[model samples]
Target: MPDAQKMFERITLPRDAGLPVSLCNVSKTYRTGFGLPVHALNLVSLRVPSGQALAITGPSGSGKSTLLHLVGAMDTPDEGSITVGELELARLQERERAAFRSQIGFVFQRFHLLPALTALDNVAAPLLPLKVGFDKQQRARELLAAVGLSGRERDLPSHLSGGEQQRVAIARALVNSPGLLFADEPTGDLDSRTGAKVMGALLELRSKRGLTLLIATHDAGLASRCDRVIELLDGQIVSDSEG
Candidate 1:
């Protein structure tokens, strides 16, 4: 086990627990160079109970990524508030947000692994900067193996298949044993069959770890596997249903 495994285990991964997240009247707007406004989210509000697996499905420009970004604390909304457990995202200062982010894991549709790093190093990257008491490489190894990448730890991102790279991103996201995980198009870049396998692995990991999962994806197959699914249109929740 890595130091992070022990150090943050109690803080992040309590038994049968995950961060409960909520948004109230959340809105985001972006302006182009010409000063026209694009409303990403308009008065959006939702509640996700702890350990619930929720999916966000919508077409392009439907505010899927914007919602994730706001909930993930990567960006702030123009109005309203977001609460996760006891913390309010809009109120966290820059430095506080950085520290708060350790409890959150995000996997983008595009695998953003550093091109120069091997799979192990990429997975171990987040722990390298922390003062953890356990071996970081060992933690990385365990995560890689959990994602069915035990023997390929030495492969660089460019050398791996699309699904493998996505798994590596997932491994990296879970390296900290985050209480919450956000995945945008978790399987978008893979073949339908491969995408299904990757989503299965992600959902299995989510359940095994008791993580509150939020995923935004266009693939209906991917969305249908979650505990709940909400579809977005023009930045609003058009449909919320059981997945």
Candidate 2:
């Protein structure tokens, strides 16, 4: 097998370079039934240093997904600011935000793989939209191998196990060589053993690529593996500590 480290080196930023994420007094509110305003996040603020692994934990209504969405640029905050590296996300124009998102990878709980596409095609799909000028297929193949999906590139999502499908999703997320990665309950669909294996692969990639990682999960075991953990309750931060 090709060395995973070498494969990562081809797509990673310099070892000394890592992106820092900062949120200052961020808040988001939603209008629900009866025109009532639901505060999804109330003055939430945090900082994740470069190359650090941070876990976000909370109960079902604690705004974990909302927080992840804001940080990942999938949604904008109604108040305060979120800055990744030197770019202020809230202030970016729509086109600029799209460009910025291209530099960040997101892994959702559902894996989000197209069932009809082979693993290789699924990983390469993002590149087509970005108009990236390189061999997308080669990069996709390398990422699949790096994620230990070698020889399974031709398999459809249905053919793979839950863990295998998640791995493929991870490979797809990394295809653009993002400087930061966001995962929301990446292991939620898998058994414990498989979850552990998937987490191991994620951390290994984070270390090798100098990529900042932020994960939102309810599993304490998974949260404990991160460098730090933040707990939320009722849309507010209740505690933050080292893992």
After the best TM-score superposition of candidate 2, give how far the Cα of residue 75 lies from its true spot, in angstroms. Answer: 1.4
- TM-scores across all candidates? 0.92, 0.91
lDDT of 1: 0.88
> How many pairs collide in each candidate, listed in order?
1, 0
Alpha-carbon local distance difference test for all models: 0.88, 0.86
Per-residue lDDT for 22 in model 1?
A: 96
lDDT by residue (1-243, candidate 2, tens digit) is 334333333333332445889999999999998899989999988989999988889998889999988987889999999988877787766766666666788998899999999999999998875544589999999999989999999999999999999999999998878878999999888899999898888888898877899998888998899889999997898999952
Candidate 1: the clashing residue pairs are 3-134
Taking every candidate in turn, the Cα RMSD to the unseen true structure, in Å, is 3.5, 6.1
| Model 2, residue 136: C-alpha shift (Å) | 1.0
Per-residue alpha-carbon lDDT of model 1 for 169-224, expressed as tens digits?
99999988887999998888889998998888888988888789999999988899
